[model samples]
Target: MSLLDHLSEHHLLVKYTTKNEMEEETRDEGNIRKEDQCNTVKGLKKNWQKWANNHSEYQKHNPFSNNRTVTVQFQKGEEGYGRPREGSRTQQRGHSAHAHLEKEVDELCMIIKSIGEAGGDGQTRVAFGPLFERYVPISNKLVGVLLRARKHGRISFEGEMLWQRRDDDVIITLLE
Candidate 1:
């Protein structure tokens, strides 16, 4: 017997039932002509042949020559795949720099608040030169902290023009 006949006889071949047949099965039984059933089977056979041919062509082009399979090497007590235990020096430095910047931002906020309170206007003008000297030694780092503070609504600029300029002498008013 052919492979199709053998599979069909053993009920191993998956039967493709049409939507109408499924709907009719849910309602009442209806008689279907033998020719129509034969046509459906022929269509399913054609679809299967097309799919098989495409798959064969794909395999021919992308043949799996290597028998080796990659296996993950995990440390003792490791559960699943994740980030490596030891990170690069740059990553460590970045984390340290971020932490340092956060500390500087906190100090800067306190200084700005104190300066604003002393002025009795709830606003204080801060120049970059003094800010760099007082809170953060690095000018760029101080700028980052100030930008972050402004973004979080902790501070506001005096004017629109102040944002575009970041000169050492440029003065910015911090508002509570």
Candidate 2:
């Protein structure tokens, strides 16, 4: 049922016993509200640090670092502001940098495909599936190769197909 219905059914508002005592009871509840909020903040920060450490370990090779270094500093009695600052550099430049990086990565993939498709000697055709599958196992290595190929204006699609293959049976089965 809805929160209002549940509270009404439990006689939550009737706890004062009489109408005259309602204001006094509400004031008592208000007094402990800040303590509850402080406890919640501490709990949330503890959970965040735990999860952030795990994330940093998993994505160790990622250029973008996880929030392992994130600090949650708040006064004992203060409820910190949750809203973003309108004039912050993080709000303005950060978004543009993120968008630019995404576009660059997408372009790199397209370039890799083009290079892989056009064989230098013009012989047998290279398939994308097998290449993508093989490359995924050594993604760190493959990323380096792609970066080098991009510099020379070549998109290496030769192993693109291999990277697409699912070497992990667990992941493939989950999708099925």
Candidate 3:
């Protein structure tokens, strides 16, 4: 008997199997008689309406429906396709300073511990230039490190002139 007749007799959905799937079945399992599979579908029901309802529900709530395309225009001599565009000078400086501070956190903590241990007072006094020379060998990232340390409750200003002092001038005490 034909495949459609076999499917209809057992209440199986003919649309569920594509032409490619049917071809693959014929090529791969040709030795197994269709009657054996057809007999096994005795209690199965062909519920096309239920499948259609589920598909409609899935399409309604699909996230890809909200996706939109964005276009960026690049002018002449502007590097856009390959390399990243440079940020504003102030923003770049701030980001680099912040990164430098983060990199120096452990070293700064160790310096504070050592200074506090050496000093007579329980708090450690850290001046920018000496601290910078001690910890950061290459660049002066002491201001950012001290500011971040202050924000994190690791240090605080000792005097009233916090931001007014020169690079080598400001002294901050380590918090216990």
RMSD of each: 17.8, 18.6, 16.9
- Where model 3 places Cα greater than 4 Å from the true spot, the runs are 1-66, 69-103, 115-120, 138-140, 158-165
Write the residue-wise lDDT of candidate 1 on 37-119 in tens digits: 68997999999999999766544433262424443456666773343224546468878977986776677778765544334
Cα displacement (angstroms), candidate 2, residue 174, comes to: 21
Candidate 2 residue 110 C-alpha distance from true site, Å = 1.5
Worst 10 residues of 1 by lDDT: 61-70
**Each candidate's TM vs. the true structure?**
0.33, 0.23, 0.36
User: Compared to the true structure, candidate 3 yields what TM-score?
Assistant: 0.36
Candidates 2 and 3 compared: the better one by TM-score is 3
Q: Please, what is the whole-model Cα lDDT of each candidate in the order they appear?
A: 0.62, 0.51, 0.62
* Strongest candidate by TM-score: 3
Model 2 over residues 25-133: C-alpha lDDT tens digits? 6778788877786898799999999998966654553335564554444556667444233555656886797686556555545534543444455422334444445
User: In model 1, which residue pairs have backbone atoms overlapping below 3 Å?
Assistant: none
User: Predictions ranked by TM-score, top down?
Assistant: 3, 1, 2
What root-mean-square deviation over C-alphas does model 3 reach? 16.9
For lDDT, the strongest prediction is: 3
